[model samples]
Target: MTHPELVIRKAVWKGEEVDLLVADGKILDVIPSSDTMYEGAEVVAAKGLLLMPSMTDVHTHLREPGFEYKEDIASGLKAAVHGGFSNIMCMANTDPVNDNAVVTDEMLRKAKAAYPEGGPRLFPIGALTKGLEGKELAPMHEMAEAGCAAFSNDGLPVKNSELFRRAMEYGSDTGKPIIDHCEDPYLAPAVGVNEGEVSSVLGLAGQPDVAEAAQVARDLLMAEYLDMHIHLAHISCRKSVDLIAWAKKRGVKVTAETCPHYLLLTEDALNGYSSDTKVNPPLRTADDVDALLAGIKDGTIDMFATDHAPHAAHEKEVEFMHAPCGISGLDSALSLTWSLVASGKITFDDFIRMWTTAPCETFDLPLNSFKKGDPADFFLFDPSEEWVLDATTMHSKGKNTPFRGQTLKGRVISHFLSGKKIV
Candidate 1:
């Protein structure tokens, strides 16, 4: 018998039926009800819901310090918690650009200060190049000492391969990851939409698939050469997925992530040239979509990330080619991922790994699982409940979401962060 602070009976963990007991923000015990007894604790009946380890988004843009018009740290984090995330990593592309130790430190300070009453943990990433200009490397050691969670040059790829290799070497020495936005500017010059029949029909400039694959190839080779950890962000092209799979099989020290948009939407989404579907490493063909989802199933893709880029109304409300690239994905990422699993495309256990375990491992966060002594960072969701996204009422300050009006299967009934209810 154990006297826990709270007990959730009939929780589904790792797809198995179990009772979860929690105390002081950590799981205390899990036992078969027939062999267990609770003395005094608050009970939550979780018969139909899945008790998943807290979700983590390794790719998200908070748009703070300068782009408050789009989103701020507080608003972005609030949206994340409501969406059942317990930990999230913010990208380094910001106002001052989190390239220097000072800017990186400020990002971390503001993120810490913006913690909601009960919300997901925020981890700030530092830039790899000074100002992310790719002309010169930033002070990697200094930013690492300042508590940056990782090093990245997201949103912009380092065009200079030599400089990128130098950054990788520095990152390896410092034990920091180089998260790259892999898109070769040369192969996909002046393109807007994905290179495909859809783009051809719409008369839009095509962003060839080689753009993404070329960068992934270069970075993976660099990572292997340097013996450094490299993480590719928002992979979209079919060849990009195949390249990662090939590198992983060859034992390269590489890891990568793809966004929900890539898995769920295709270049067909860009046929109308709606800015909402516009994203960096722009959405690709249906073949690319199939490959992305296959990568998730086969473990080639490390995890699912939102790549939750947000933009102001004016920035995205204009005509097709003129609109900025991005989509707000934090809230809709998980539900859509779950739907993919529920439809038998992927197993539930595998889905959990992508959303929970894999992400924490990628970012070097504490191993979060539904086990005793682990933090009570969890999301309780009725997997059967239907949900329709509504950006007007979302917690995010930015209202640009591509999944608006889309129906999803699961709903987060409640979320517990540090043993306290948040949603």
Candidate 2:
């Protein structure tokens, strides 16, 4: 059962009209549309569509090995493909946690079976601390040998600086980034919202900006001292952005990422106590949003990730304080990001670089490109398409999104992974 070669005709690629030829799971050629004539190849007329390298999300939670009611690898991969992402790095917060080689091996086996014919590739991040308890280090050497992309105690931050320094020292030898969820438990309340007008007016326990920026500052200093790479996850405060900029200026091996929700939504979204807006490192003031946008524009922020945490409907249907702190993002990340491009906050090329090239470079994943012999992992996108996001239509099992019912511009019309159309 041999598949025919795929030829995209008259597609707009890198601001020019070109024809793309994909065969044997690799891009064979990319030439001007007017110069090519493929009489027998499977032709796809992509006259007005845009062709760009597919996206890669470095932070996502596919609640498998325990929380399948929320999301599994199969359904999560579906959401990734639908969101125009060809690769995703999953967090190790599942039942039994991916702290050892056995769990990493099991996850890889499951992912391979899920995408047997070619879909989004899954990279598992091993736990930085055993059980994510943040007391002792996990078996990093064993997990790395079994295919873990990085080490993180995500969901919860490592509170002990000495323990984190030890982990960074160990990780420097492996050459993988030590990614941490930056938050000081002492500064953050048990049930926390952003410490500001929203929390004050609503009479809820507030998690101040220092809860995140303090940890970020410590991690950056430790990375500089230890001469190791540290990646910050889901930075949401102005102070955190400023700290990252200062660290980069001083030549520290530090990189940071932010989610789309932090850019598009604000504390205003919580006016009615919406549980969907109850993300960890809760949405901040308009000034913080402006700072994050500036960070993106000035290249202070290295990458953009979804932090695609999914939760069961029952888990998110409760009161804001009782509800789990996360929202399903794999289904809406790209669309929300396009809003930035549409508003001129970031250019189209910059969006592609942040979502695709930057993450791949930072995490040592395969660089997605249109070069000959590169895997045909890309998508045809429509920049002018308008559609309302209905959570019911989402491919993920979780319907916990703050963007439900919002009209968004731009969408992935078709996606190809390994030369096969998956959406």
Query: What TM-score goes with each of the models?
Result: 0.95, 0.97
lDDT of 1 by residue, 1-423 (tens): 446888888877766777888898888877654435566678888886788777888988998878989999888988898787888888888988987778767876777788635467777788888888889898989988887778888877889889888888888778777899888877765355787788879888888888888889999898788777888887887798888988888889888888888877887877566788877888777788888888888888888888888888889899978887788888777788887888887788777788889888877875557677888888788888887788654778766767888777787888888778877
**lDDT (Cα, 0-100) at 247 in candidate 2:** 95
lDDT of 2: 0.88
Clashing pairs in 1: none
Residue-wise lDDT of candidate 2 within 1-423, one digit each (tens)?
233398988899878999888889888888888745555678899999999788999999999889999999999999999999998899999998999989899888888898887678999999999999999999898888889999999978888889989999888777788898888888864354788898899988889898899889999999889878999999898999999999999999888999998899888888889888889888999999999999998988888999888888889888888998888898888889988988898888779888998899899887667888888888999989988888666888888888988888889999988888889
Model 2: weakest 10-residue lDDT segment is 184-193
Count of clashes in candidate 1: 0
How does residue 57 of candidate 2 score in lDDT? 96
